[model samples]
Target: MSEHRILKLFFFACLGVFVLHFTMTLLHNTPEKYLTPRMESYSHLWCYPTFHQGWALFAPEPQSKHKRMEMRYYGPSGWSEWYRAEHICMDQHIRYRVTHYSKLCHVTQNTVYHLWMAVDHFDQQDRPAEQFYPQNMGYGIAMVLAENYAHHFLPEMEVHTLQIRLILEDPFELQDPEVIHFPTKTLMDGPE
Candidate 1:
């Protein structure tokens, strides 16, 4: 192939991948009922690190609420003060050039979003809180991530159980903030 033709072909291929990536990301993030079985089957592609999509820059809908993830740990000394993971990650990101700090900021955002979605699902079904925690994937992931984060940061304290709470406040200051409490997960216990 001629050089010009090769360059043109490469451009189109790059464009194709860009378009496909965003299209798959949109479908993957959409409600499952809206997707056909085949599309739903490919949803896992977006979960890959290379293809991951986030809404911080341009959300489909504007974010109207400020969400914060706060965690507290229970040890022999009793429950510690609620630690704001988001703030810590943001501070680290601001102070250092390390990429892990930025990644943790994104992780905190995803954790809050996942936990909130799980909460909304349970609320709509009128499910009991006891039954919701174990069955929800988001809850399970959040609990484990939160516990690990606590253990990593507060190594001196032995954390038996960690509790996470999502604080949602209106970005415009139009309403009072609401706190969604999650069950305290036992981190020291072995897997069931």
Candidate 2:
């Protein structure tokens, strides 16, 4: 193959990767923050606690709300600006059954991590959608029961629970992690 052909092939490969990544992100029911009323004033901050103890396997259980959404981290000032109704959205499934609980993570200075708000809820067809409405879409909580990576799938010695904390500052972090979430306890019942 000619040098030009090789370069062309490499360009196409990169393009393909980008497209696939974008499509997957959209399918994951990404919150269109750019379209929100708070976009002009929104910010995010985050953190991840060391989980050498064990992982908290979260899932939407019976008699609970099976819902999750992105909770952008903002400093104390930004958090103060947030009103429960103005900032967060619901999965509707939990509208009548369970109350939702959410908390933001705090990381060490100069540190970064993915804030696992929740995974996108998949439909009967296994497609991502909150309902019939694309805007209502979001991910469910990922079940993390412990912290260990015995599987070769993870880099040896690097297989450990992520100490990621995501902060959604108005400026936003240039890079971030893609952590997932799963519902834990029902909020309606209150205190475990």
Candidate 3:
């Protein structure tokens, strides 16, 4: 091959390697894990750290036998930034909570703040099989993280809430503070 052609090929090879490495690193750092009803699905209980954003999350119990999932948060700016997600089971009268939050900021200054997402899911059941206790879905722990954004924004800002949604594969992008909702359900008693 000519000198110019060889140089171009080398450049492309290097670029590909860099991209691969970056992608792998991102997945590794995220620490994704699969969990079932028997085991607690929570990975990192602490604030899910991210750049130019803040987080508060919790892996909660399914309101019913169905709708089991890992709820997560994503966005920029921190405050009473409460965001929630409901994983509606394919076909079952169940609504549960899996609260997961993320945040970012400089480690030096306590310049940002956030709060625990409230009982994001409604407790219409009032009580489940184990009567008495108000069994419902909500933020188990108020996770907080420092969002670093030196590369993007000028003045440091902690994301209070993330514009959450149902994406099979959602990138960690900055979004508005909002909750993602789906049809909720409750089982009914009948003479069957």
Q: What lDDT does model 1 reach?
A: 0.79
Please give, for residues 23-77, the per-residue lDDT of candidate 1 as tens digits.
8778878898899989876765454334322344444666667788898888888
For model 3, residues 1-192, the per-residue Cα lDDT tens digits are: 899999999999999978865654454456346343222212222222322123333324311111212222232332223222221221111222232112121211121111111222233434432232223222111122211221132234333332222222222334433333322211122111
User: By TM-score, highest first, what's the ranking?
Assistant: 1, 2, 3
Question: Please, what is the whole-model Cα lDDT of each candidate in the order they appear?
Answer: 0.79, 0.28, 0.29
TM-score per candidate: 0.64, 0.20, 0.19
**Where does model 1 exceed 4 Å of error?**
1-60, 189-192
RMSD of candidate 2 to the true fold? 20.6
TM-score of 1: 0.64
Model 2, C-alpha of 172: deviation from truth (Å) = 28
- Count clashing residue pairs per candidate: 0, 28, 27
lDDT of 2 at 27: 36
Model 2 agreement with the true structure over 1-192: per-residue lDDT tens digits: 999999999999999978855554443344555444343222111111111111234423321121122322222222212112112222222343343212111111111111122222232345442342223212211112111111211223322122212223322233443333222222122222
